[model samples]
Target: ERPEEKLEKPCAAVAPKEEALKPKDMDRSTSDDDDEEADGYQQKGVSIDDLSDDWVEAQMKDVTVAVIGNVDSGKSTLVGVLTKGGLDDGRGLARAKVFNFSHEAANGRTSSIAQEIMGFSQSGEQVLIDRMGTSTANSRNQTWQQVVSQSERLVTFSDLCGHEKYLKTTIFGLVGQCPDYTMIIVNANAGFQRMSREHLGIALALRIPFFIVITKIDIAPQNVFDENLAQLHKIVKSNAVKRQPLVVTSEDHLEQAATGIYGKQVCPMFCISNVTGEGLPLLRSFLQRLPSRLQDSGLFKPPSSPAEFHIDSIYVVPGVGLVVGGVVRSGRICPGQHLLLGPDKVSQFKPVMVKTIQYKRVTVEMAESGQHCSFALRSLVKRETLKKSMFRKGMVMLGPELQPKAIWSFKAEARWTVGFDFSSQSILNCALVSAHFASICPAAVCGASRNVDVPVQLCRSHGDQD
Candidate 1:
C-alpha cells in the first residue's frame, strides 16, 4: 500500500472524528508508541494475578469480630492482648498486615477503641482482623451497615459497661444480637459478681456458645481463683446452661484446660492476664478453632456483618463538623458513605455523610467494629433523633429509620440463674438496646425472670408527614 494510505488508514480507522485531524496531528502521533509500551508490559513475565498480595488484599473484603463484655472487665485489654502481634507499631494488632486504628495514644500506642477497628479486615486477604471494645457513639455509628456491604464475614463481640449502674442495660442489649461464640471475661479476684450471673443468663438464653476468661489471674490469690471457679460452676448448673462453661486457670495450662472442657455444657473458664500476655497463644488457637466447630455442626455461617451502628456519644469537632461516638455493632463505616438517621418502622433515617473517624478518642481516617472512637458528620443531627435511630444500648449511633413510636421491644427468653424471679412486679430497672427503663410492666413476675419472656419496646414514634 502507499505510505499515505497506510498512515491515513491507521489513524482514520481508529478515530471516529477523522475529519477533525490534520496532517500536523498525523506527524506527531504517539498512539502507536503508547500501545507498544503497554504491550511490552503485558509481555513481561508478570500478569495482573502476579501483583503483590497486598494490592489484591486492598481490593478484597474482610471479616469482623466484635469484642464485648462489661466495662472494666478487660474487654479492651483482651482485644489488645489478642491482637498484639498485628500492629504496625505497637505490640498488638498494630503490627498486623491490615493494621488500622482511629487514633494513636500519647505513648505512641494506637487506639483500637472505635470504628477504626474495621480497617483491619481484608477479604480473602491474609490479614488478621483485629477489633476493640467500646460503646456505640455518634461518630462511628454507621459502621454496621458498612460491614454488611463490604465484608463476607463478621464476628461481633460486645463489651458492656461493667459498672453496676449500667450492668442491666448492657446485658439486656447483648442478649440476642451478638456472636455465637462469646468470650466472657471475669475478674478472678472478684469472684462471680451478680452482674456476671446476669450476663451469663443472657448468653444462655441466646444459646450462644461461650468460654470464660478469668482476668487478673496473675494477681488473684490461689483460693480466690478456686472460689471463683466454684461460684461459676454453681451459677452454670443453677442456670442449666446447655453448654458447660470452660475454665482456664493459667496461660500455661490452656491446652490442657481446653481438652478437659470440650464437652457441651455451660460457661467454661480460662485464666488469662491481659497485662502479662499469658494464655494469649492458647486463646488465639482456641479462637481459630471456633470457626471449625461451627462448620462441624453443619451450622457454619461465615460471619455476616449485619447493619448495626452503636453510637457512643455526640460532640462537636473543632473544624470538621458534628461528631458522634461509639463502637460499630455489626458492619463497617467509611469516610464518605451516607447512613439512615431514625426509627425502625416509621421514622425515616436521613442520609448523612461521614466526614472523619476518631478512635480511642483520637481522630483517624477510617473505622470498623470493635474499636471505640468518635466520627464526624457533615451536619449535626438532633440528639433525640440520633438516640431513636439506634437499636441496642451499646449501639451508640444508628442509621435513621421511620419515626420511632413504640421502641422495638422483644421477649426476653432467659434461664434465671440467680435468686431473682420475674414474677414480682417490683420496678425492674433495666436497659436493653441502650435505651434505659426503670418501671416494670405490671405483667412481669419476680425471681422467675429466667426464661421470662417480657415484651420490650422503644419509646419514640415516627415523624409525621407535613
Candidate 2:
C-alpha cells in the first residue's frame, strides 16, 4: 500500500467526524444565545409576551359612568364638551353633537341610551382633540376608534334621557346597562328639581355611588349656584342618604374622592360650566381617576373562567347575517369558539359559533372578560334569513358548562338588609319589567370600560361617534 493512500483514508475519516461535531457545537451556541437574550430581557423587567400592541391595547383600563339628571340639566352637553373638546354655544350646539336621532337634535335632549368615549393617554392627555386647535366655537370630533386607539385609559359616558317621557329608557340605562358610576347633573338655577330628587333617591336605593355636577354656571347667578350646592350637601349628608360630599377643587381632594368612590360614602361634587369650561378640568381629572366598581366587586370576571355574555342588542349587518353586541361578563371569547346562545322564547339555548370579534372598533381575534364585544355569529342550526329577530336583549350567551335549563318562574332568596318602601318596591318591579323589555338597543357596550357608547357587531364592524 502507498503511504499517500493511507494518509488520505485517515484524513477522510477525520473530516466526517469534524462535520458531525460542528452542528452540535453550533446548536449549543444557538441555544446559549437565546437563553442569554431571554435572561437579558427578563432583567429589564418586561414580559416578552406583552410586546404585542393589540394585547396591550385590549387590556387597557376603562371606566364607565352613567350621566343622569332632570330635563335641560346638560348631560349630553357636558359629555360633548369633554369628548369633542368643544364648548357649548349655550344653545346646545355641543348637545346636538351626541344626539342619536334627528328629533333629539331638534329638541336638544338625549332620549335614548346614548354613549360617548373620552380617552386619556398614559400621561393623561385627552384622546380627543379639536380638529381646529384653540377653536371653542366648533369642534370636529375625532372617530371613537381613533380616540380609543390613541388612549391608554378610556372613560365611557352613558348619556340617558333627562325627560320624564323617557323614564323607561332611563330605567334601562340604570339597571341593564350596568354603569360603574352615575353622575347626577343638577341645574344651579333649578335648585334641585323633582326628577333630580327621584334620581338621587334611586341612586341611593340602588347603593350606586353618585356625584353631582352643577351646570350653566356661566349663566347661573352666584347665589343660585351657592344655593344649589348647599342643597346638594344637605341632601347627600342627610340620615337617609348617609354620604359625605367632597367638593373636588384640587388634586388632593380628587385623589381622596377617587380612592373611596366604590363602596364608600365619599360623594364627590363638581361645579361645571359646559359653555365657559369652568371646573371642566377638575371633572375630567376625576373621571380619569374614577376607579371601576365592577372590577373591584368581582363583577369584572377573569377571562380564564367559563364565558358569560349578556346580550343587550342585536342587529343584522348587510354583509353578515346576524350579530350580537353586549358585555362579556366572564371568561374569554375567541373567534371560531363554540358557545351557547339562549334562553329563547322556549327557554332553550341554541348552539352557536363565533365567527369574528371586534373591540373598540378594531378587529380582535379574542375578547377577554370586561370588554364589550360583538360576535358575528353562525348558527349551528339551519336558520332562515332574519335570524336576529329570534334573539332578544335579556338573553345570555354562555359556555356549554354554564348553560342552565330555562325556567318560567323560580323563587330565590334575596337579602334586603336595608329599609324598604313603596318606591323601592316600584323600582324593583321596574327592574323586572326592564329585564323583560329586551329590545331597548344600544349600538354597543365597550367593556374595556363598563360601557363605551358605541357599536357591537357580529359578522360586522361598526363605525364610531355614538
Candidate 3:
C-alpha cells in the first residue's frame, strides 16, 4: 500500500468500531489509533498538524546568506532559480529577473549588492511557487506574506558583486551586513579564480562559517568537472583553513553536514546545475535545516536594552523624505521614537524622529534586534540644514540613553599583518579601515610600538571634514 494509504488505514479501521463497544472503550480505541497514525507520519518526516485545514502561524526565523564569487560564476542565476522556483533556459532568462539596472542586464553582470529571499514551510515545502508552477513579482510578494505567516524559517540572500572592480562594494556587503553565513559559488567549468580566493580569505578572517557551491555542471565535461571538484576538495582541506571537505550526495550526508555547519570544522560542498535543476532539492533542504549562528552565539540583545541601528544604505523618496535601510544591531526600534543619527564632521550626533518602519517591504510598527528593516526619518534640524549628503553609510541610529560618541582615536590589538613595512615613527594617513560592524572609512594610523598595540585616528574622507 501507499504510504498515505497505510497511514490512514488505522484511523479508518477504528471508525467502524463506534457501535461495537461501550462509549469509553470506543473513545480509547480511537485515541490509540490516532496516536499510532501520528507516530507513523512523524517517522516519515511529516507533521500531522501541518496537514490540517486550520493553519497555525509560526514564529519566523530569519537567516542572512551572502553570495560571493568571481564573475560569471552563476551566483545570480542560482539564487533566481532557487527563489523563483524555475529552471534557467541555459541563457540569462533566470538572472534577468534579479538585475536591477538596464546596464547590468545588457552586460550580464552585477555591480551592486542585491537581495532576494526564499521561504520554507514547516514541512520543508517551498512557499514561493504558485499554483501555475511559476513565480511572478506579485506572486512573490504574496508568497512572502503567506510564507511569513505560515512558515517557520526564512532565508534572505545578499547577492554581492563578483567583478574585480567592484571588490569594495562586495566587501561592504560582507562586513556591513553581518550575514549569518556565506555561500561562495565557483564555476565548475572555469575553476576557482583570484577573486574567489580573496572572498574566501575575507570570510575566514571575519570568522564566518561558509560553504561552497559548484555550478554549471550541466555544461562541464565529466572529466573536467571531476578534476575541478578534486582541486576544490584539496584547497578546502589544506593547511590554511584546515577544514574537512564534505560532498553531499544523499539525504544522510546532507543532514549530517547541516548539523555540523555551525561548528565551523566541516565545509559542505554542493554541486548543482541551475539549467537542469539537478541537486537543487538537496541544497534547498540543507538551507532549510541550517541553524542561525547568531542565535547560537547568544549575542542577541534584549528588547529592553537601548536601540542601535546601523545605516548601510540611504535614500530620499519623493514622499517619504529620508529613508535609511540597515540591520538593528541591538535592542528594539518602534515608530515615533526619537534617536540620534550621526558621527558627523565634528563627531556629533543629531536628533531625528522615526516616522515609519518597514520589514521585508511590509510596514511594521516595531523592529527588533538582528532584524533588517528600513526606517523613514524625520529630522529635527531646520529644513535648510537638512541635506541628504550629510548622511552617509557607516553611521548609526542610537538611543539617547547610551550617550554615544564618535571617537577619532582608539587602541586595537593586532591579530596578524601582511605585506607591511612600517617603522615605529610611521604615520599612515588617509588609510581606509573596516571595523567590526563592517563600516569602512579613511583614518590615520600612528604609534605602532613593539608590543603590537596601535592607536588609529579616524578622519572624515569627504565634504571638507578633515
Candidate 4:
C-alpha cells in the first residue's frame, strides 16, 4: 500500500476501539444519577493528531476569497502582508510586490484581478515564507508547490480593482471567479464610500457570505476609527443585511466567528493594520479555520457525465502553440483526450486534442473535476488562423459526444425594481443588463413587461453597437 494509505489504517483501527470503550465506561457508574451526571461530562476533545487520518486528509481544502472595497482601502497591501509574512512600510512597499503592470505600480492601484494564495499546515501554521534564499519570483512559485504538497488547506485571495473606473473588472471577478467568500476592506480614515456600498450590494445580490475588515487602524485617530466603526455597525444592522456585527478582539472571538461563518448569524469585523502588522495573527487564524462553503452535492458534476471546462483565459506560450486556463466544471480530462472548443464566430465547436495538462504549474497526467488547470491544445487549424478565430472569453471545451451550440437570445424571469415601469409592447433600446447563466455576459434588454419574463439579447460588448 502507499504511504498515505498506510497512515490511514491506524486511525481507522483506533475508532472502533474507542467506540467499544464508550459503553463500558458508561456502565461503570455507581448509580443512575451518577450515570446521568457522567453522561453530561462524557464529551471528549479530539485533537488533530487523535482524529482519523481520513479527517486530516479531507482537511486539504481549497477556498477562493475575493477582496474588494473602495479605492485606497489597502486591499493589495493587506493581501501582500498576509501572503508574504512581511509588514508594510506605510508607503506602498508591500503593495508594489503584488502589482503585475508598470502602470498599476505607478498609480498605486490595481486595475485588474490579482491573485495570491496562503496555505496552512495540519497544525494551522502558515507556510508561505518558510523557503530560504530564493529570488522573489522563484520563491513564490516554489512556495505554491510546497504549500500544495505539504499543507492541509489553501486559501486563494483574488484582489480585485477598487477604483470606480475599473468597476467592470471588479464585477467580472465577482461573477466569474466563483469565490467561496468575500472580504470587504474599509479604510478607517475614509469611513464608508459610494463604491464600497456598490460592492456590498453586489455581494448581497449574489447571496455570498462576507465579512468586513477595517484597515489602517494604526494611523487613524481614535475618534475617526470609532466613528468609522459606528457607521459600519449601523449599515450591517440595517434592514437590508440584518446581520449582527461582532467585533473580533480575541482568539475566542476568532474561533467563534470562524465556526459560525456559514451560519450567517453574525458578521465578524476585524480591525487590522498592514503597516505595523497589528491584528494580523487573528485574521490568519480565522482564515485557517474558515471552512469551504461549497457543499458536496454542488462541488462537481457526476464522473459519468460529459466533461465541461470553462475558458477564462487564453495564452500562447513560446513553444506550446495555444494554452487555455480554466476550471473543470464537470467530469474529468486527461492527456491525449479529444474535446470540442467553441463557440466560434460561426457558432460551432471545433475538435481539438489535449496535448498536456498542468496543475499549479506542475505537469500532471489527468485533472479531475473542481480543480483549476491549464491545458495545451493541439489545434487542427493553422497557428496563424487559430489566432484570428473566436477563442475569447465565455467559451467552453466539452466532450464531443454532447454537442453544444452558442446562444444569442434567451428569456429570463426578473423582478422589476420599484418605480421602474415598463410596457410589454415597447422595445427598450440600449438597456445594459448583466446576466449569468453558464457564464457572465452583458446583454441588451430587448423587451420587458411588468409581472412577466424579459427577453434579452446577449452581446459581446456593452456598447449599443453590439
Candidate 5:
C-alpha cells in the first residue's frame, strides 16, 4: 500500500458546503478498506476533470516515425548512412557503432560526445551508431527508445525488420497509433515482384511517407531494364499508387528518373550499391534533403512544447524494472515528472513517476519527439499486463481503461494464401495483433443464432470459394 497520501489544502482544499449532498463517498470507503485493489483511493485522490482539453493536449507527446521495409532492402544500411555519414567512406558504418555526444567545456556547447564516451577517433560528422537489438522482432523497438533516453537532442531512425514475412505483420502495429513517418525499400536486382505489390498496397492504404529505395543497382542489367520498368508501372498503376516507379541505375543515367519520380511523393528514389563505391554521395545528399521534403508535406514540424512521447516497445528489464522504450514523439520527459498511466482495464490511474530517462547512449534531463529512448519505472508492472492493459501492439501501446472495443465478432477479409475450404475451420493468424482465434465472428442476420452465410472477404492469392 502507498504510505503517504497527498491532499489539496482546505478552502481550495476543503470540501465545499455541497459536500453534504454527495453520495457518502461509499465507493471510496470500500476501496480504501480493500488493500489489494485500491483503485477507489487512487481516483478520489486526484481529479483532472477540472482540466481543459487544451491543457491536456498541451501535455500530449509527439509521435515517432518507424522506418521499415523488406529484409536486405538496405533498411539498416540506409539508416547507417543517414545517422553516421556517407557509407562510401566506411567511416559512417564504423562510427555508427559508437555515436554519442560531447560537452564543450569552453563554450558549454554540447555536441555529439561519441568520441568521449566510447573513446573512438572523432570525425567531422554529427551522427552516431545505433544499437538496434539482438532480437530481430521483439527488441527492435527497445533499441529505438534507448536512443531517445540517452541523446541530448531528439533523433529519429528506422526500425528495419530482419525478415520479409514479418514486414506485413509488423506494418499495422505502426498504423494510426502515432503521427509519425515511415520509409519503404525495394531492390532493383529483384525488380518489382508480386509479393512487393502486396507490401506496396499496405503502405499506400496507410498513406505513410515512404520512399522507394532501389538497392543493389551495380549488377542491374540494362537489357531487361525496360521490361522491369514496364512491369513495375503496371503493378503500381493498378494499385493507385499515384506515383511512378523511381529507377536509380546510374547516377548520370537515372538522374532524370530520380528527379521526376518524386513529382508529388516526398520519399525519393536512389540507386545505391551497399557493396561498391558508386552513387553513395547522391544518396547522402538526398537524405540530407529529405527532412525538407517532409517539411513541405507538412509532416515535419518542430514541437511547441515538451509533453510529447510515443510508445515504441514494452519489455521487462531484469533487475532494473519495467522498461518502456519509445521516442519523445513531441515533448520533453524528465525524471520525477508524473505521467498518467491512464484508465487501466479494471481501474483509472493518475500521475505515475518517470523514474529515469535515456537517449542514444547517455542519460538526459528530458527528451523530445523523433528521439529514441527507454527508462525504468519506480514501481513494477508486467510487460504483458501493460500491453493488455494499454491495448498496445508492438509500436502502438496505450494505457488501461481505453479498452479495445470488445468485438464479439469481426468480418475478417482474409486471403487464404493456401487453398482451403471454408468448411475446414479457417484459422489464419492475425499477424499484427499477434493473436489467433477460430474464425468465428457471428452472422448478425441469422435468426437461429447459427453461423451462416457470413460475409467473408477473400484474397486473390488464397483460394476461397463462395
Candidate 6:
C-alpha cells in the first residue's frame, strides 16, 4: 500500500514539460487539493509529441571509434595525440600518456583495452586534455564528465591491443564496445602486415565500416611510403575487400568521404605523422562531422524505453565496493533506481538498487544509451550478499518492464559440412560462435530470451573446415 502511494505522487506532481529521464531528482512536493492551482500546472505540462527531433539529438550525441592495427603500428600514439593534444617525441612519448600500466609505458606496448574520449565544441574546436598527474587519477587529463559537459559532442576511442598474443583481447574490445566506426592504423615503412589483415578481416566480418590511416610518415622514406600506399589502394580495390579507397589529402576529398563513408562501401585513407602533426587537422575535422551510426539508424534517441545495461567489465574498488561497467544499450539509468541484475551460476537474477552511477570516473546524474558507465549496486533483498563469483561475463541489468530468462538449453540445426573443425573456440552445439554474438546485444540468444533466432555458419579457414 505504501509503495503504491510513493509511485503515484512522483507521476502526478511532475509536469510533462520536464525532460524525459530528468537527471536531477524531481521535487517531490506534497500534492495540493486546490483546483485552480492544478489547472495552471496542467497548462505547463509538455508531452513527447511537443519536442522536436533536434531537441532530442542535442541532449545526447556520442560516437565510438575502435583503433586497431598490427603491433608497432602507432595505434596508441594516434589516440594519445588526438585526445591529449600533444605530439610524439619520436621516442614513444605521446603513447606513454595513454598507457594504463607502468609496464605498458616502459615496454611501449598496449596490453589491455583502454578508452579515451575527445569532446568537440559546437563551433568545431577540439577539446584538449588539460592538467595532469594522479591528483585527477583518470586515464585522461580531466574527468570524462567534465570533458563531456564542456562540449556539444563526444567522440570515444577504444585503444585496443595490437600484438599477436593479445588477439583475444583485441577481438573482445572490437565486439564489446560496438563502435560506430573503426580506424585501422598502418605503418608507412613496414606496410600492411599479417596482424593488420587480421584486424581488417575482423572489422569486415562484423560488418563494421572503417577508415585507414598511415602513420609515421615523417620517418618513413618517400619511396617506401608510396609503395605501402599503393599496396593499400590495390587491396581495397581487390575482389576480397571490394571498397573504393579515397586518399584524403584536401578539403574536397574530405567532403566526399564524409558523405558516403557511413556505409561499408567506401573506405577513406589518411597519411599522418605523430611527430610533425601533418594530417592531424584533416582527421580531426572528419571526426567532428562523423555521425553516430546508431543515431542515424534511430537506435540512439530519447531514453523513453525500458532501461537496460549490460555488464562488460567489473571492478572492486577499495572504497566503492563492487562496481560493474558497461554501455547502456537502449535507455537511461539513474541512481536509487531498481534493476534486475543477473542470470548467475544458478540462473537467477537478483534485484539490486543502484547506489551510484559514474561515467568515465566522474559522478553523473543520469547515464544514457551509448555511454559507458560504472554502477555501484546494492542488493534489494535484505540479508542477501551478492558474491562476486556469482556475476559472470555477459550479465545484464534490466528494468521491471522487461522479462528476462537464463536459457541453459536451446536447439539449433548445424549445417552439414565435410571435414569441418569445431576445435577453434569449442563452439560445437552452444548458442554463440564468436565474441560478436557474445557482445550483449538486444537480440541475444537467451541465446541470454527475446524470441530471436541466431544461426551459425562455418566458414573455411586455412584450407581446413572451421
Best by lDDT: 3
Q: Against the correct fold, how does model 3 do in TM-score?
A: 0.77
lDDT of 4 by residue, 330-387 (tens): 6667665657777655545666657788776667766656667889876543332356
The pairs that clash in candidate 2 are: 372-447, 375-458, 376-458, 376-459
Off by over 4 Å in 1: 1-159, 172-181, 219-224, 247-266, 274-278, 292-312, 323-340, 343-466
TM accuracy, model 1: 0.46
lDDT of 6 by residue, 105-194 (tens): 888889998888888998989876465333234534355666877888888899999998888778878777778899999999999998
Structural RMSD, model 5: 13.9
RMSD of each: 18.4, 19.2, 19.2, 17.2, 13.9, 10.3
Poorest stretch of ten by lDDT in candidate 3: 5-14
Model 5: per-residue lDDT, tens digit, 1-466? 2111221110001113332212233223223223233333334333333433243223322223454545445555555455444353422342233222222222222121111111111231233445543323335345544444443333244343435444433443344232244455566766765445555555554455555666666667875655655665565445266565554545463445434433444234555666574666665444333332222333222433424344545667666566777644444445644343432322233223456676544555454434456765442221222332452322222221222222122334433222111122334342222221111111121111113354432211110111
Residue 211, candidate 1: Cα error in Å is 1.5
Q: Report the C-alpha lDDT of model 3 over 316-422, residue by residue, as the tens digit.
A: 87877889999876666766565777766555667766777878767775677777899988665444335688777768887766666554444454343231111
- Residue 402 in model 4: shift from native, Å? 2.3
TM accuracy, model 2:
0.75
Comparing 3 with 6 on lDDT, the higher-scoring candidate is: 3
Clashes of 4: 0
TM-score of 6: 0.77
lDDT of 1 by residue, 209-251 (tens): 5677777777889987898788777666653554455554445
Winning candidate number (TM-score): 4
Segments of candidate 6 deviating more than 4 angstroms: 1-56, 132-143, 296-302, 413-436, 440-466
In candidate 6, list every pair of residues with a backbone clash: 17-46, 445-448
As a whole number from 0 to 100, the lDDT of residue 461 in candidate 3 is 34
TM-score per prediction, in order, is: 0.46, 0.75, 0.77, 0.79, 0.51, 0.77
Better of 1 and 5 by lDDT: 1
Name the better of 2 and 6 by TM-score. Answer: 6
